[model samples]
Target: MSVIKVAIVGANGKVGRLLVSQLKNNNSFSTPLAIVRTQDQFNYFKNEAGVDASLTDIENSSVSEIAEAIKGYDAVVFSAGAGGKAVERIFTVDLDGCCKVVEACEKVGIKRFIVVSALKAEDREFWCNIKGLREYYIAKKAADREVRDSKLGYTILQPGSLELNKGTGLLQPLNKIEEKASNNYSINREDVASFIVQSLLHPDATVKKTISLVNGDEPIEKFIQSL
Candidate 1:
């Protein structure tokens, strides 16, 4: 089979960097198009991660401009985010930016799209109870809705709290979680990248599924296959 070509938005971010690294090292995926906003980011992926990239300011670009930037890739991953606590950025980066990505993918005819969302984003009660996280969750929720509504083959991964630790290669699909049981909510960024790679290489494993993830005892491949 031919290698899958991918375009990753926000390729300089924490998870984006990891995803670029993993995809480059793995044989299943081709060297991805690392989309970034600035020269520093383009250099970071080229020099540090050793991947090919393009410069496109997603927040400032139109949907058509973004679409042209990512054309010719087999798939796209929406991993961009606004790192600060800015309320306006939540809408711009998380909601509007992702919606633009969806539009770009649709225009370019790249049907395979993977989105990295946060856990409990679909839960209105969870958003209401969380302090100072409502806007972020709201943005994530809105973006996820747009991806699902689009006419594309998409997998929406809603991972729990993320940490910058080593991957365990183990995870728990939230659907398998026992009700009312205390679950470990933190997951390594590397593991999340691993799951995205697996989902990309094994479309049957996650196509059209919105899965919640957390660090658990089941091996990553096994858990994904089980889904």
Candidate 2:
């Protein structure tokens, strides 16, 4: 089988790191491109993770740099995010940065993209009136809109509050949970990573829709094989 090549834009992040590790271990992929921001991050993955991840700019790199990073990959994962509530950075990185990469991917003919977003984003009036994170989601919603129109094969995962638990691989896309039930149904980063990989490998799953991911007890490997 010809292994697919994928590029991870935010390769040093919690979710991004886990996905990077998974992609590295999978024989189905050509070595993935890991995009990083700082020297510290570049060194961390190079030394600690012991992966073939390459450093590229997610913060200050030119649009051409991003284009070059993903030029030959079969899929590109938009894991880059602007930390904290800084709404300005939200539009810049999460929205515009992603848009720039998508344009680059299109220019280079990379057809697959997986973007990680938040759940319950449409009802963000609660967060936007005050919280900075909520404002960030507003930008994500717009970015989602752009991906919908990109004519690219895309999978958007909208997980709730992220957790650090083990990856069971079962993703429960439940409807609005009761406020009290929201204790820790949050998903682990690994689960999200597995979903990213599965979405890329599966040909029948809906491409342009946003799917919610949450804690579940099913085996993810089984899910992937079934696909």
Candidate 3:
């Protein structure tokens, strides 16, 4: 099989960092193009992670500018975020930025797009009731909608509360759970990153599907195949 060249937006973020690391370790994926917002971020990925990177301020860049930056890659990962509680920044980075990435991908004829979204984004009423997180959810929901409606082959992974602990390489498809238990939620950041790389490598895992993720007993590959 031919290797897939991927451009990771927000490659400096926590999950992005792990995704780059995992991709480097896997032979199926090419050395990812780490997309960041500033020169400093580009340097960090180059010097620290030894990955090729470029600067594209997503908040300000037009669809064409973003598309130009990611022109040759086979796929793009939309993991960039504002990383704060600020409402405006949330919309800018999560909603508008995600839409731009999708539009850019479509413009360039790159059909494989992966997005990391929050759990329960589909349930707006639940998120809106939770203080301080309404804006974030709103942004994610909007971005997710855009991807779902687009013609691109897309996978939206909606992992629950994220933990910084080491990955277990195990997970459960949320749809498989018979009961909507809260304990079924929550997954390690490392596992989430691994899943993203696995999903890219295994296109059948969750293509054109939005999956809810949580830590569970099933092996990652099996779980993905079952989906």
Give lDDT tens digits, candidate 1, residues 81-169: 99855899989998999999999999999999999999878989877767888889999998999999999899999888888999999
How do all models score by TM-score?
0.95, 0.87, 0.95
The window of 10 residues in a row where model 3 has the poorest summed lDDT is 175-184
Q: Mind giving the per-residue lDDT tens digits that candidate 3 earns over 1-227?
A: 79999999988889999999999878898889999998889898888888888899999999999999999999999998999757799999999999999999999999999999998798887688877888899899999999999989999989887889999998876665534356647789899999898888878767899988788888998888788
Score each candidate by Cα lDDT: 0.88, 0.77, 0.89
Q: Provide the lDDT at 52 for model 1.
A: 90
Which residue ranges in model 1 land beyond 4 Å of their true spot? 176-184
Q: Backbone collision count in every prediction?
A: 0, 0, 0
Residues 64-128, model 2: lDDT tens digits: 77788778788899988887746688888888888888888888898888889777565566457
